[model samples]
Target: MKKGLLLIYLVLCQVYVYAQEDAWVYLTDKDNTGFSISNPPQFLTQQAIDRKNSQGIAIDNRDLPVNETYISQLKNQAGITVMAKSKWFNAVHVRGIQEDIDALATLEFVDYIDFANSSLNRSASNSNRQDKFEIEESLIDFEYGGTQNQVEMINLDNLHLSDYTGNEIIIAVLDAGFPNVNTMSSFQRLRNNNDLLGGYDFVDRTDNVYEFAGSNHGTKVLSVMAGFVQDQYVGTAPDASYYLFRTEDVGSENPVEESYWVEAAERADSLGVHIINSSLGYTVYDNPNYSYTPSQMNGQVAFISKGATIASEKGILVVNSAGNSGNNSWQIVGAPADASKVFSIGGVDASGAYSSFSSQGSATQSTLKPDVVARASSTFVIDQFDVIVNNNGTSFSSPIMAGAMACLKQALPSVSNEQLKQFTRMSASQYTTPDFMMGYGIPDMQMALNLALSVQEETFGELKIFPNPVKNELHIQLPSDTDTTLMIYDVLGKLVLKKSFNSTYQKINTSSMISGMYILRIESSSGSKTFKLIKS
Candidate 1:
């Protein structure tokens, strides 16, 4: 009789373990009267509030933190595992069995229960093979192959020449995982300078992102933005600060990953990230019912796309990759990329032609999808082994464009995110007639900077400055005779020279200034204009 009871007990234990699965328990409300949006500092970083203030974004209920009372009540429940929480949707994501889920539904605060993945299966990234595309040697401009050319192709180096290397800007990279970034020699500078602001593994519910076992795809992705190895390799925004987030589950494609993504994005916003670069996307899932139809790529249909749009509405610039399905039957971009607010990126070749494998856009809504394109085929990046190599996909293209955008943001901090988007689209090669393949072609960063400068110069028109790399003298040309106060400050923001003059043309002796970058602030009765002057 005792032996029979032991057997029964073992059977019950097996059933208990097998019964548990992943499900989401949606809470109706926070139900906390203590929290308020007026007290933003209690939840959001000052930098986050500053970004919203600068962009004219108002603080709302969505900015409020999740109710701790609801969380405490859910935590006390048995057989329920809370995975993540989202303030935007006012929901809690949990993993539990059918019986426990049913019990939770009976609670007064429980709104409903939704299954994230009823079937225990992994949703893998489809067609994500790391195939090395062939490259013609003749098309290569530098020893670095398409990596250096990609920067020059878009005139991104011009921004670098102006010393805008993404300094002071924070970018959050949301992907699968970063394995070697913590130990890679190529990332030594980032590690030594303390630019790698640390990371979190949402999938495992751990803070040890570096020690976890994950795909190297995220390592390569981040290298395209922050990797630097002197003349051997230079990323687009090598000096930018970064926060690494592992949201993708390399083994699975499920609605849970979407929730994880939204949670990560919300965290990034609260931490004051200026930009988010996400190479992950969602379309098909293991469960047919959860898979999204191509018609659903209208941006509003996908949960991830909606979350991405909300992130943008909160004044964060989201950059996502257009999926790689050009040759497949899907032949279209994925969610979040379909969201108009996202800076969706597609792939191109060194020859400025759209890659045959790059995804096409224009949602079922018939709106242009990918905002721009960058070199993807034969795109160069550092591998896990610390070797410089080429890879293919819209994944590389997205970060390439994202890094350059960060550099541009550093250069023009006063330019609002929306204005920057408009200037960027206008700076594209095919802005006049953009199609699905390459929304607005590759953007020219120099052109965008010039356009921004022109707008800044509108208040004081027809002003020409010459001898940019000046050693002794600098000349200014005015459209008409006007009284002006010219103040020149060094890169350190120290005033070097101050002069008041009234003339159509004036020559200022710059011999006394040191050889470096100087800010020329020209203030007149009409307005003030500032120019970046290089002294050689």
Candidate 2:
């Protein structure tokens, strides 16, 4: 009996290595048109694409096996608990004893192997960055809205645009609970569209999460992501689909909540959730031993954070809140948000400064956290009864930004998630340089879309408008072996130049043109289209 016990313990220790042998995140092996398994519909192509992005791996370069040969070997073997036919990464997710893990690292195709246990549920990430700009805290009293942003918060015409709206994209919002959300008038369109996919309650370990209420955090979260209340407050992407997840315990402090987050994330993946907006985080927990040290911010200590990272690898864009400890002594960011793979979001005031209460970092492991920021302090949300309330914390900031990402995703459906992230960063308020407070800075989604779609200046599809703020010289591009048309118009909607081409390329010398706001429209038969060209 004693010897048997020893053997079992040894097996558990080595299982991870063995299990990892063929497990990999297949980024380049995508064929995603759609999915239909659960809430958001589980899509592998999406998940894998996300993983390839954070690793700094090029989308094309993502094809290399995290563990290449071990995958083939495991597929050939017969006794392994897991078997392979075809896989997300061209590798299989193997099940083995702890004794197997070491071997996994040696596998050629194996990038890194992690337990899949946590993916089923995950906690909301916490608030992190704070606005550097400080104003009267009561900006909402006179403002009535929330934080005073240069761009005032706008409300959606939910009552008026009920059936007629251009928003049709799927946006998964991972929050706490949806109590009364189903019965609210504000959420009527969401109910009508049946846009909400099924969700799991990771907190109480039961599905009746909606019934148990408090501040109805989840309801408020949904409102911010997709609520439509005219003249009051509006979410950035109100028309997007939603999958509400309950992963936090507004009541407890046990360290176990992290596990719940992991569980939620797995479910999100299985559902092929387009975007996961988790506004919870872990730094200190109920257990004294559980309180994470700054080192744990590396993104490897917590199961939920690791799952968040893996989810990103799988192509599901995960936007997480940093933490609300920015004003505290331990102002460093929290777990999962620290996960190098996830997009860590910070809170900022309208002036584009970091929120004082937003957490800070460059992570210990995957440093350079809080990828972006949004209005957090003094933000508005809807309670369970559909009443609007102003709140503070990075929690409010995450959904605001997530809403924007959904719109961006809808606008640039062809760009890969990795490209989208990169493009957004490049097009940020501080792309050329970065500040610790706001990271890469805020994003200009439409501008990002334009840049992503822009053809190389030297290439035919490349459309160039030169002489900015200029009195002359507007140039056009012509690519080889392609049909082309270039049209220019002034701000007054006057058509300035319209040309049809039979040559590989054409150049329009705007040198003889007037300087003002101009729009250039380019269209291609290959389903390629771009809009908004500035002519100076």
Candidate 3:
């Protein structure tokens, strides 16, 4: 009996060794055919092209699709499972035996083979269940219910009141799965208006995301953004369009999910998604050997981090959860959340206090993370049954902030993705003294929008107003010499002053004006310019 047991043990060890041979092959270059930057329609949607043109972003080789010939030939192989493909890295992820991985290196198009899995030793215990810290659930009558606190906490209600409901803005949500979203009443408006674009279940290689048997985390996460049920609960961006993507397999954690996320991001870019909300983060894995160390939390280390950064560079706003590991032994933000360009959101309570389970960061490489905070404690989200459930975690916070960003985008469509990030950070309450746990602290959507408006006015309008809080005199500078008609009005739209001039520089006297705020509109041959002015 002892001899038979030893034989079985040896065989198991051999199988484990073979499984460890899975790798990702990076190709040096792609075969140039059928794709061109000048002709973007072949691989990019018109919306995507328009976004690039609006931002003055140049389409280059990175926008090109991966060589289909190479992918087709690779798929024909018997022993390999083509898990994911990345256009940004020009690589293909595969699961195979040692012999097959070794054979891939010899291919002429292959650049080099690298072990995609981390080499760190995994813990003997395979189970590492993450705990979620949530506060009490409070029920209320139909009318924004418990969700009103979250929107008010971030000051996004002001924007909502302004009628900026993220109309015409496209957001792509990448998560585990979105089960029951199609039938949920909260999503009825989305379906009625065709706001819910088609989605895919990448884990199962199917386009039926709603029918897939998976976690309901995605449905809840998305509810924080697009769900609406009269006064019971209303998401931040109720009018925004969405594309749901299932990139995670909750049963296990491995490098393959990172590849799946990259593939989804690439698709989002091609479809002209303006924003991507990812409530998923990675760290310890089922296979200890595939887990990432804290030191590897640098923005450039993880594959998902790199992918998120590339997505941001492509003019797409990428928002990620900072992970719910703050109270655990591994108390730090996860990959993709550590990415510099990715807006990592932390969780706080309605009273502006940090949640105990919100991940802290300044990565091991010492870069501040959890770029901003949002109310997640006892946050209201729609369940698969279309019921509001109070929950907590950065997962809830991420979508809340993402929805706000969609509104901000709708208000300032010309602001570049990078500039949007800067504006949000600068508008945060703790911008000048950000801490590791909360980074820039909670951001104010109204403040961020105001800042973005200033930037856009300066960039396009080319009109400058000095001494904004003018006591008696106000000056306006136009970009060029043209006939200009200036009109000033009170907040109620009552005209206060009107003047005409043709010089590039002009000044007006307002010594008798009362102390208040007014809107200054300039109509010229170039265009119409509006400015918010204050009087002392």
TM-score of each: 0.77, 0.61, 0.82
**TM-score of the candidate numbered 3?**
0.82
Count backbone clashes in candidate 2. 91
Q: Write the per-residue lDDT of candidate 1 for residues 238-289, one digit (tens) a residue.
A: 9999999988887755677888999999999998899999987787765454
Q: Whole-model lDDT for model 1 versus the true structure?
A: 0.80
> In order, how many clashes per candidate?
2, 91, 4
How far in Å is the alpha carbon of 403 misplaced in model 3?
A: 0.2
Q: Whose lDDT is greatest here?
A: 3
Residues 233-287, candidate 2: write the lDDT tens digits. Answer: 5566667787666766666554445555655665665555668888887776432
- lDDT of all predictions, in order shown? 0.80, 0.59, 0.83
lDDT of 2: 0.59
Worst 10 residues of 3 by lDDT: 118-127
**Mind giving the per-residue lDDT tens digits that candidate 3 earns over 55-128?**
88888888888897887777777677788899888989888775677677777888977665544112122337
Q: What is the descending TM-score order? A: 3, 1, 2
Kindly provide the TM-score of model 2 when superposed on the true structure, using C-alpha atoms. Answer: 0.61
* Candidate with the larger lDDT of 1 and 3: 3
Candidate 3, position 137, lDDT: 44
